[model samples]
Target: MTALQSRIEGHILTPTGFVLGVLTLDAQGRIADISGTPVATAAVRDSGAPIVLPGFIDLHVHGGAGHDIMEGGDAALHVATLHARHGTTSLLATTMTAPQSDLDAAFAAMGPLCKQRAPNAARVLGVHLEGPYISEARLGAQPPFARPASFDEIHRLHAMAPIRLITLAPEVGGNHALIAQLVAEGFKVQLGHTTGSYEQGVAAMRCGATGFTHLFNAMSALHHREPGMVGAALAHAEFAEVIPDLLHVHPGAIHTALRAIPKLYCVTDSTSAAGMPDGDYKLGRHTVTKCMGGVRLADGTLAGSVLSMDQALRNLVDTLGLDLADASRRVSTYAADHMGLQDRGRLAAGAWGDVVVLNRDLALQAVLVEGHAVRLN
Candidate 1:
């Protein structure tokens, strides 16, 4: 294979939450070396004002940049490219609660895209099956018609595609056994969209549910008397996902949750309306309306979000008043570790040279996937 060459100069944010001097990528898309001295190459670019960090990875995103993953086909691949331009180097094409036929079609469409090797496309890490099996009560933005997944159905789908991660309600029927089966099958299980009590949530965790979906939203709220699902997630504290938009979660809550959990990763939880103007869009069978800094349904129920990972990092710093290193951990290291992605999510020798260069303003200036500059001015 012909090698590609490039050098990014700035404060390099390694996945371990440290900022180093300069990073150079060999022609073969691996970190060649890092030194204070610049490499003698024409591909050298001054990333002085921006923070060079591992490209953000989204494990749970239904749609963004005006395309829904459920829409499938090239539209799915097209939207993936859009997110790549915005600094998402890796992502899971998430699916919402929908009819069996629709879900099957989506899986069929994404299977090929996931296998195909593309330079500009954001790496489709794996499929994140949000639901077809969840509680109807806490379904959140998912369609009511597609609620709940049976054991047989789950097994069938798993057989069809290589499912990497899945989210479900622990209190739902057959969920406990399904969780155990999924763990045995080597899939990451996350609890979400339910009204499960603290005890129930704890039970799920014991059964191998290691993460939470979107932290504080789409599930039972925390209460002093009840200590619901949120309390259970906080109490366990080893693994969870937070949207960090300052809209999906408040700054105080995020800080508190981070303090409570051992590892809290940040995700966009962005919908199809993301990276687009305020308007109506489809998130599965539901119609999402975005306006004046928030997205909601006709019934005023909060839908997903319109935030990007780059902006999410900025929100953690500006809105939450967190240091750059802390914010970078939530966006990069924490998430990568939770999903078991060891090769990427860090800037080190021998790791995939997936990096994002941002300006001092936190705007995405350029992105390199596997050491090749996929997005640049």
Candidate 2:
């Protein structure tokens, strides 16, 4: 981490929008200034200069580099480094449903990593506790240890690694009230892994649940009358996360979501197979195989994915027909807004100097986490 100030020239995507300019990073790793020069929008589309965008923020991440977060021992560091190479400046270390003892052990090893930035790695912002409070009926790729919400357990784990978000079933055992409590205490709560009806989902939102996890995957489907979790999210949600690997969610469904939710963001939901060739790898307790550019279980369940944030961005634009600006919002800005992190997402004065410099083809040329450059190759 350098204390010296730095600058980069390119087509910078600032908070107000895109402009041809120079972006300055302060010695302390916050955005110092951006000096803009007027240029035609069409000119930027074909510019040889780097296209600088806010670094990606992934709220749902399990692992990468052939290592699971549950494996402990520098695994999270390796995963963070691998993702940093792909432009993720910040991420949540997502956990799967597992026994309490195992969860405790994993947190015990990773909690400190959350508090500081490590070398050549994305900032381990916090934890996304994705399980242990879900529904057994909708375990998806999660292990089958689903249980009801418990305040004591939640507090204990939060004390370990500050949980930024949680995924659970509000219709299950006293969890609707728990959602209220978690929100009141400043935690972001999301509804998922459920057989909940539309009304239950609405009720959860009323109780302060702010988002949905991996929309339309493990959650219930929308029907003409029943209007399950998907229906609720599409009808009422302003914010939601969806994996855009083109395998977890179809391009057509993604287009529908784009028109429905205002702050629909993209996440990798990536696993240990992310940067590796096709082979078997650990995704929590389950062993998943990477084949045909996707990860799956022996039972043919779609496990996590081998997608990186850079590839996710490409899919949003090249395949899904979104413009670069809207695609940048989906991959970066909206997630930061959902997390209430003003300092991490945009290229503005006083925001963290987290950036990804891409070329005309939207390939990563450089990545920065708080002004520190990470290796791309």
Candidate 2 lDDT over 1-377, as tens digits, reads 33433998999998767889899988888899999986654566687988999999999999999988888778888889999999999999989899998788778778889989997899999989998899889899998889998889989999988899999998888888888888999999999988888999999999999899999999889899899999999999999999999999988899988899999999999999999999999988899999999999999999989889999999988999888888899999999999999898788899999999999999899888999888777
The number of the candidate with the highest lDDT is 2
* Predicted structure 1, TM vs. truth: 0.92
lDDT of 1 by residue, 116-208 (tens): 546676788778999876788988888985455575666676665567888899888878777887788788999998899999999999999
Report RMSD for candidate 2.
Answer: 1.2
Candidate 2: minimum summed lDDT over ten consecutive residues — where? Answer: 38-47
Q: Which ranges in model 1 have alpha carbons more than 4 Å from their true place?
A: 1-3, 15-20, 37-49
Q: Give each model's clash number.
A: 6, 0
Q: Report lDDT per candidate.
A: 0.80, 0.90
- CA lDDT, candidate 2, residue 156: 97
Model 1 clash pairs? Answer: 4-27, 50-358, 132-148, 133-148, 133-149, 134-148
The most accurate candidate by TM-score is 2
